[model samples]
Target: MAGTDKQQDMLAEGPAIILVEPQLGENIGMVARAMANFGLGELRLVSPRDGWPNEKARAAASRADHVIDAAVMFDDTAGAIADLNFVYATTARPRDNFKPVRGPVEAAGELRTRFAAGQKTGILFGRERWGLTNEEVALADEIVTFPVNPAFASLNIAQAVLLMSYEWMKTGDQAVRPVESRPEPAAKQHVESLVAYLDRVLDERGYFRTEAKKPKMIENLRTLVTRPGFTVEELAVLRGVLTSLEKFSPRKPRGSGAPDAG
Candidate 1:
């Protein structure tokens, strides 16, 4: 099964991810995957080089089909964000414009605040190479940039989307599911019983070789067994393993045993 829960509806209502003249279908698909990772689902494309409904994008998106299937295409940058009340244009290079600039984190927080106020917001991402032109940046209400190495600051189209998507999600309150199911903790009696059984077996095997060290060794053994606070199921498995080891015995080689008789 896919990592997503089909039972729950996708979060398709956050700020739009607008890509201007995106070049690759794979990058578009990957951008969808990244958006899905963080719960933002709206995707807007402006004049994609390979055109819309690209199969290469679908394959690259992994199982994030909802984002790809719901993507909206536009003829130009202006049309892509026409309905949005606020928009942010992302750029790596410093522009000569006077618009307010924000880092990814601050932009995400602002998006959350604006969204709460019932304002529609969107972020504009430029081409895979060269990014948004100065005129395109002017269309946005504010500029958002990344704090990257000044010497080399260019980012992949999908990578830029992922960073912004992640920041947007981080600003929201979402619960993370636990990795594994946890059973009830073992009862105190169950823990003591296992410890007692192991102590008996070890004593029989002469594991506590010296009387002076025996008490400390037993104490250490008890501590080790009790430290983990094993679940009920785990305790049962341990007891079963101990029982099997106690009953096991090595058999003599068949040929050696029957050599004299032969």
Candidate 2:
């Protein structure tokens, strides 16, 4: 779909995304697309290998014209992040330095706290092949690492940017929480109604045939029905099922349908 003027106005206000010596124009474009997906606006390129104004990158970015149009170029990593007050470097391997290491979620939370307090922040991503040098990782205040399979932890440049961006977006968004959208649990009356209906059906079917076990069986049946905490709709469905069985079944003994012995 074509981007609209209104959509362009909804630019994200968060950390910059810095690419240190990224190799491919296609990767740059995909990075732009990922940034756009998560509401990240600022994109800084530190000496991209394929050079600047790459048509391949622009074409690959697809509908994220705003990100491609506003991308800034820098000669080195230091130049790329010089303006930011806080910076994070993303690396899969543990560096020798004692810098604070955080997963993407924790890093995003820190970034959100800082950004909201009027501090500029950004994250540094390394090259496509060898990743950042020790010196580059040292430049950032903290390190961000992905919790991936140790045997194969390599991630593409765009994929890395997408992960960080998604987490950053989620930091301030309560919508991602499962409990936020969950329907309220069914009321006590609804559950009681279901339990009563079940008890009546089982009692008529001689489920509690033994006089001594009748009270215990009823209690167990009520416990089983109430344990699930069924919603109103679920209770209605259960009641409909019980009514159907009662309407269709013969009033004879439970084994009346069995074959007669010779």
Which candidate tops lDDT? 1
Give one digit per residue, the lDDT tens place, for model 2 in 196-248. 67666665665555556555554545445544535568878888988998897
Segments in model 1 whose C-alpha atoms lie over 4 Å from true places: 1-9, 174-262
lDDT of 1 by residue, 198-256 (tens): 76776665566555655555555544564454656788999899889878733333222
Candidate 2 TM-score over all chains jointly: 0.63
Stretch of 10 with least lDDT, candidate 1:
253-262
Error of 2 at 121 (Å): 0.4
Off by over 4 Å in 2: 1-12, 174-262
Cα error of candidate 2 at position 63, Å: 1.1
